[model samples]
Target chain A: MVESSPPTRLDALLDQLATDLEPVKPLDDRPTALVLAGLFAAAVALVLAWLGPRPGLLGEDVQPMFMLRSGTLAVLAVVCVAAVVAQAHPGVGRNSQGWKVAAAMAALFPLVGAVVAFTDPAHARAMMMMPTGWQCLRMSLMTGTLCAVPMVLHLRRGAPVAPERAGLLVGLASGSLGALAYNLHCPFDSVVYIGLWYGVAIAVAAVAGRLVVPRLIRW
Target chain B: MTSDEATLARLMRESQGGNAQAYRQLLGLAAPLLQRWFRRKVAPHELDDLVQDTLLAVHQRRASWDPARPFLPWLAAIARYRWVDRLRRSALRNHDALFDDISVESGESALIGRLGCDRLLALLPAGQAAAIRAMKIDGLSVTEAAAQLGQSESMVKVNVHRGLKKLAAMVDEDA
Candidate 1:
């Protein structure tokens, strides 16, 4: 009788894995998209239930600035969420540069606001005198929190190569979603108000995500 | 994608569907690739363990792979993540072992140990080299090294740890 050599450790591990293996559904981008959509719908619904929409929201002559602000926030939220979702699938040629472009586009809001504020003294004074600006900041952050929690939970399912980047994206996504929801009820449409308060709120969320998210999703 | 990658991707897709034979074959191919990838990044003693850890990671995160994408990059990313994780773990271990136990005795053997380290020390920052030389080669205690170097005791320890880590990295690169 011929005797065979012992099975090596790797062989043993492989056999064990194969024995324990079960059918698994491949991860797709759709589930993440659906999650984000649901969250947005919920946030919008909550806003409508808790605080009524700004007067003339459904009117024919709705403010152009309001549309622009909401549209920018919507785009930012979608782009950031997409970037975060892409982290789950690791690939060499795959890149998530869309979020950066979206972020830059979003930056235009604050930049134009800053330019307007500096060039026009009256606008600057108007921004400074608005007492409800802090309320806008608080409300935006609060709304962002609604999105950030579930988004982080969803992110935990995948392995992100750069945890810090994923975290930052999650924060930005949530903050934008929050800002978008808050925009429905926010009566102030000044470029300065949107730029300073909304921008700060999103920046704070991104920083917080950078600090906090990596710790939760490391591995 | 290369033919090899196409085959692997097909195998992966089959494995995801509970095809044990395909899954086993995929892992069989993956093990050697992981070994070669890890060989350059880790010591010989750690090579097998790193390969196995990466294989286990690949198994656990298999679902993370998007079918439409090429397979090799996804595998490479997972391997890179493991390599980094191993480096971090070793650094932490070294940090914890910093002040465990040391005898301040000098002899010919110690001199022999110091012979080749001058080259290594030269590659480090001046402060780090000085701290490493005082504490490691000369067999000085942390306090003694700090007093001799005119740095704080904590700074001396920090420099020695950092210097040792750099030396390890240099050796790794050379290997």
Candidate 2:
């Protein structure tokens, strides 16, 4: 049998590795998963923003419960979209040397905004406009967490995934989850704008993923 | 009556002048460091081959060894390049392994290296915990790790970094 060869499995592996192979070369997905779960909160911010200012709180804090700020909403959306694209294609666009750039950019947006908010909460608050700051942060955190979950799984899988498809899946899943959770805080009296619109955006992205994922997958 | 330094210098000059004995002595002196370096990097199976390659390169390019320069650094440089070449050549298949047979310093005589284990153990997830133990306790290379876990080399490396980062962060956080 082939198993009975003089070279043991490790011997063969080492022989191949020494003669030919080569070397070249994510984060922990669990915390990212829980954080991802917060995209559900992306719901409350987007919906309330467009529905004219319904400031509801997640907790009992009735101090104008405008947690998911519009700025955060946009950040979450962009991150979600990036995640979707990454998921769809997996490793496709990565070796381009610009992946670190994209990753830095994706990671930078929130930190910059957070710093901006810290510098001048009043002006920052004014520019942020929507009473959705907390919600939006939660959304970004959630979507990041959510998209990161599957991405972690993908990394752990170690089978090559199409980078673009990976991104798409990340974005769509994060978006949808953000919409659904955020919607729970929706006030029945006013129309839930984000709950409706963002939900549709995420759903559309998911369907697009369906199309893209198929194309991305090897036959 | 020549000092080791003079003898070493003479040997270097002689090796450069194509003295096979001088070349052999230079290689004899350099072998330990190269072997150790390669041993840390590759599977047990690949370690000798790589070390041989490193020595062969050193011999082939004997002129590159500047007499004014300290020898170890030059040899280390050779080892590093050889290591990089090995990594690049195996990029596709090895990309999935985690540690890639790099021997951890704690591996030998690690049974006595009890200082970091308790704290390190506190930080690791299951797989990383095991890896640190194997590297520290059992003294296996990253390739042996793949064999142990039935995973890829890149995956092993990834896990090691993640585990290491976590361990480092835990130490920092604790501090």
Candidate 3:
């Protein structure tokens, strides 16, 4: 079946490849990937249900600050997930700038916390001494880790040109999802606590993803 | 999209649907295009292997392509990834003779013609790019590269490794 007047090795190889070809389902689109990631969210919900919601999340008296923070985290996690999904298909989605903007917006929580700490010595000490901060950190990371498993597995299904960035996105999305999951149970709503604990947890998750995910997903 | 691009997209759509003839035609057309693409980026001796490697990658990763999108950019992205990967491995292997006396004829096409070593190097940090340029492209000894760049010998090695690593990570973005 070689058509060239003088067949080359590549033509032979090409023929071999074509002979072995079979129908393949294309990789999942962005929505499908998001839904796959969402399946893990149910695990987060189960854990939250076991732990019990932050006492009053469902009640009318819930703080608007809590709603605002949780909303921000939810949006950030979705954006990160979308960005990571785009990584699987090269040239399909090249909007690397989208996640950066979302990340910057998310950073404002920690930035405000830093400003509060630096500007007011008394409140800074109170924020540092808060008893539940470490617990929030642990739970957030645990939640994120749960979300991360499926995301990593999802990324492995395709060829990611930037494995490191994709790994980081996996970490960020899962970490934020983790924070959101734990936010339903966490009692602390202060900008200082959320900033310090959630920020560190997400940062740790992102760093861990960057370091580890590439090795797992590299093609 | 051009007529060729449209034809390629159609062929790929057929290939995904389990049409072997379309797949063969797709690969047949793709092989020469990849050869021209890699010509400017790789040594002449390495060109054929790189093209084959890329063709194989395209076959392996064909599922990642969406029928709605134009085919060439996806092909280009995969090609760039393979090119960077080949360079990274070669850089790690430290094959001194591979790059020697390398000269490439200019390619006639659009997207592939724009890529060259200079453009590839520009993606890295200045320090890393300089180190790769001296040690890999210029074939300088580590000691010579260190002296030329005015840094410790250890730094040159570090920069080259980091540069190659960064190049692999950034390949997807170039498309």
**Of the candidates numbered 2 and 3, which has the greater DockQ value?**
3
Query: Global lDDT for candidate 1?
Result: 0.75
Task: Flag regions of model 1 displaced more than 4 Å.
Answer: A1-6, A120-129, B1-3, B95-175
The DockQ score of candidate 1 comes to 0.27
Worst 10 residues of 2 chain B by lDDT: B108-117
lDDT of 3: 0.79
> Per-residue lDDT of B49-93 in model 3, one digit per residue for the tens?
998998999999999988877788788778878887887777767
lDDT of 3 at B103: 57
Interface Cα RMSD in Å, per prediction: 7.8, 17.3, 2.4
DockQ of each: 0.27, 0.02, 0.55
What lDDT score goes with residue A9 in model 1? 82
Name the candidate that leads on lDDT: 3
DockQ of candidate 2 relative to the true structure:
0.02
lDDT of 2 by residue, A40-84 (tens): 344455545644343444446543313443344445555554443
Docking class of 2: incorrect
Candidate with maximal DockQ: 3
